[model samples]
Target: YVENNLAQKTIELFNELKNPADVNKTLLNQMKLDDIQSSIPIYLSAIKAVSQIGDYSKAQSIFKQIPDSLLVENQIRSALIDLWGKVGSVVEAKLIFDKIRQPNIIEYTTMGLF
Candidate 1:
């Protein structure tokens, strides 16, 4: 079924995000974001990996490509915040954190912990 396929693809993408040295851009491009809200987790993981690898520009570009709706999630937004912070963009990170409607304790903790 399409649902099962999407789930599998999402898991694969998540694995790539966690270990971006193994990422295949061609395969990543095949994923259909419109069919999977769970893509947010993979996207966040990719952002973290890219930032850690000193590819902040690429991470920012990918973040920008994601829909505004997708960016609204706490996990995704938290990743963005962290990415911006890693790049020394504290102002942008603060702005994003402030815009979050209902930031949970984890979001607060992440901001402080980092």
Candidate 2:
């Protein structure tokens, strides 16, 4: 029952990905209540969808709402940086890079590509 509920929530949020601003964050508030990003796939999917449509600012806003502890992950940070760079937000990219706790080679390499 627990697994089914999570899967259902993910599906509901996936539909909302079409327009992130329209996303009812309340659905994902469980993560905020837990003081975590809660769902990596949701965050990544939102970032990817927003970036594809050239909405970096919206993506950044979503990324910012996620807790810093969860943001420490290289994949999440790198993906955000890539979105920033893609939309010519180099400063945003730099800010994210500086925020990394201890960026590894993959993070360095990913940022370099941006």
Candidate 3:
């Protein structure tokens, strides 16, 4: 869905898979290791889709759904920087960028584009 630029569809599918009732449960407690690993790609795709749709609020909402474990991943953080920049929030992007202990090429490239 993301590759095709189907932002809305991507968002819908993500929302459908997540159970709101599980809000209080940490992802680690709710899902297996494999499940979390597999969902990482989908989460990343959804972030990119949110950017394509230019829905800053939705982007933040989806961001809050992500497990803290995943947030530290460079790939996820890089995508977030791109998402924030696309949504007209350079400050948010910079904040995420600054948190990286050792930003990689992809992170630099994404942040540099802003």
Q: Note each model's CA RMSD in angstroms.
A: 4.7, 4.0, 8.3
For model 1, the stretches where C-alpha displacement exceeds 4 angstroms are 1-27, 32-38
Pairs clashing in candidate 1? none
Model 2, residue 21: C-alpha shift (Å): 7.4
lDDT of 2 by residue, 35-67 (tens): 444566667765776676677667656766666
Model 3 segments more than 4 A misplaced? 1-38
Tens-digit per-residue lDDT, 1-114, candidate 1: 145566676566657564462352323355543443436656766676666765656666666667887877878888888877777777777888899888888778667755
Q: Which 10 consecutive positions of candidate 1 have the poorest summed lDDT?
A: 21-30
What TM-score do all the candidates reach, one by one?
0.65, 0.65, 0.67
Candidate with the greatest TM-score versus the true structure: 3
Could you tell me the lDDT of residue 51 within candidate 2? 72
* Model 2 Cα shift for residue 77 (angstroms): 1.1
Superposed Cα RMSD, model 1: 4.7
**How much is the lDDT of residue 3 in candidate 1?**
58
**Consecutive 10-residue window with the lowest summed lDDT within model 2:** 21-30
What are the per-residue Cα lDDT tens digits for candidate 3 across 31-84? Answer: 333243436676776676677777777777777778788889888999899989
* CA-lDDT, candidates in order: 0.66, 0.68, 0.71
